[model samples]
Target: MNIKQPDWEAIERAYRAGALSIRTIAERNGISDTAIRKKAKAAGWERDLSEQVRKEVRNKLVRGEVREDQCANPERDAEIIEEAAEEGATVVRSHRRDIRKATNLANLLMDDLLNTIQRREEIEDEIERETAGDESGFRRSSMLAAVALPSNAKTLFQLSSAMKNLQVLERTAFGLDEKEKSADADELSSLIDELSKDA
Candidate 1:
């Protein structure tokens, strides 16, 4: 009986490519699986498979000759899966950050609108009190003139318009309608809750 020497170079190439099982490579090269395993371990070739290798493995699996378990280093395959999952998670986190930023800006706009309205009301009240007092006609005219300024009215109108637009945007972003304002608010609250929970 005659035995052939193991082709170490060919075995290393097949193992590094990660497309074939040690058993398959051994059979193809007319060597024992144990010999290939020992040579691969000695050469420190235990890493994740390349894309080409994975593709080859898929083809082999499709042909129904090789089972998934027959592939080299199941742990390396699992690590690859874990890395892909983490990449997906990072994308989700980025989207969440963008949503929170927009929400925060909307909240700030709402605060500004509330403060402006309050100030406008306070000014109107002061004007009414001055009109009721025994002030001179000249002073009363000046007070009314301030109230009737075009710029002041325009500013209030613009602020109100901005508030309305922001409200519309919030509703649109949250998949709600004008009539569902409360639902939009609730959705935002729930989103915040979700974000906090993730934190």
Candidate 2:
């Protein structure tokens, strides 16, 4: 029986290109899977090229690539801008998306004021829920239980930090959109009002 010497360069290229599995490469080369894998590694057959090479390839591909719409040259850049503007007006139509947009007010600034109104209402409803829970006398016991019975100060600090963060978020959101005259702002205002009751 005769076993011919494997074409090392071809095997390395196949491995580098991911055209052949390690097991398949081993079978073709008449070597164990481990040996084939080790040879591929030793020969500098990279599975993931260096970050610089990857970045270069990305830049090259992006520069070379063209979108289908971009090739449709009759569509002017102004038309694209106008379409984006039209879409932006109604982007926050849904209550959820409105609140989401309002939370990150920078994105929602171009959105219609109605979105901010709707988002404020959602905030108000959540505030009411919390207020009701607090009124039921269950909140104090629960708060105390969680804080007093916690295993360590870390847990208490985490809860305190979370509550403080929520306060900051509400304040920031309020600062961004001062149009509390809108329905959305009503809820947000109520939440801010309620949270700041002690203040």
Q: For residue 40, what is the lDDT in candidate 1? A: 73
lDDT of each residue in 8-125, candidate 2, tens digit only:
8656544443323456557767878797778867876553211222222223323432122422322332233233223222321232344454456533432433353446546445
Candidate 1, residues 1-199: lDDT per residue as tens digits?
8776777766665555443456666777988889887877888865344342333323332332222364465655544433433333343455546666766775676576566555866876787786776556777667756555464567567756765775665554443562422223223324433543455
TM-score (all chains, Cα) for each model: 0.28, 0.23
Candidate 2: global Cα-lDDT?
0.42
Candidate 2, residue 59: lDDT: 34
Model 2 pairs in collision = 117-184, 120-184, 124-187
Runs of candidate 1 with Cα error greater than 4 angstroms are: 1-77, 122-199
- Which candidate's TM-score is highest? 1
Worst 10 residues of 2 by lDDT: 49-58
